[model samples]
Target: MSLDALTFRPATLADTDAVVALVESAYRGDSGRRGWTTESDLLDGRRTGADEIHAVLAKPQNMILLAELDDGSGPRLLACAHIAIEDGAGYFGMFSVDPGLQNGGIGKRVLAQAERVVREQWQTPTMRMTVINVREELIQYYVRRGYLRTGRFKPFPYGDARFGLPKRDDLSFEVLEKSL
Candidate 1:
């Protein structure tokens, strides 16, 4: 799909299932393998579930920004990301683009929009996100987009199936930040 044809909107509780499916497809399981963002090699199980999306939507300061394409049938979901304002900064996470649509500049556009919303709407000075430390290629992708590796790390929730099951023992998250 063309970037010019996409529309951005804040997701509601009604979008929980679709959002979860999109995220899982982009980050975990065999479906994710079709995209460059897949973590299948390092992790196993769901990237996100309906309950998580519902919780994010229920929060006042959180939003799941969705990118949709109106392809005549209806507005089809193409990408999504979770953004929340906390501690005077925007926290970005759960980013995913349609697996088949990866590497087509859609993610870049969605990220830029999220930053704009955080800066203009939330008046935040910085945007922050955490990536699995082992995802070197993913980290570099964000670096090229102006995100700096902060070297601040957090241990992955190994016992929490909500995050995912680690295929290997070495798993942690490194924080990345950018001035908005």
Candidate 2:
């Protein structure tokens, strides 16, 4: 599909339900397992709920960009990229793509749009994100997308039930960055 068919914009409170469904389908449960993006082995339960999303939209430093695509079938939310500015740099997180479209070039297109927004709007020199240290495959995937590992690690929230119960003891996040 042409990139022109995708409209990128800041997500609103109204998009919460569809966004939640899209995220769950992309990262959790059996449906997520159909694609390489699933974190089913690492955690369970909801990813980001309506409340969390609303907070992001309310935050001055954060904005979640949703990618709505017009396929012949209908208006499909093909992907989402959550960008937050922290300590002067744009931090990209909670990104998800439709499982069936994983191998397609759509993800790169969506990411390109996100980076453009951050660089052009935030005017930041770098964009950063964290990946679970144990998820080497996912980390490598980001590496292939121009993100470089920084060797910076943050402890995963172990008791934060909102995030989910950890399946492994050594779970932590490795920081990655891409220069804008």
TM-scores, all candidates, are 0.97, 0.94
Per-residue lDDT tens digits for candidate 1, residues 39-108, read 9998887788888988898998899999999988999999999999977789999999999999999999
Top lDDT hit: 1
Model 2: C-alpha RMSD to truth?
Answer: 1.4
Per-residue lDDT tens digits of candidate 2, residues 50-94? Answer: 888888899996888888887777777989978989978888888
Q: Least lDDT summed over 10 consecutive residues: which range in candidate 2?
A: 160-169
Report every candidate's CA lDDT: 0.93, 0.86
Q: Which candidate ranks first by TM-score, i.e. highest?
A: 1
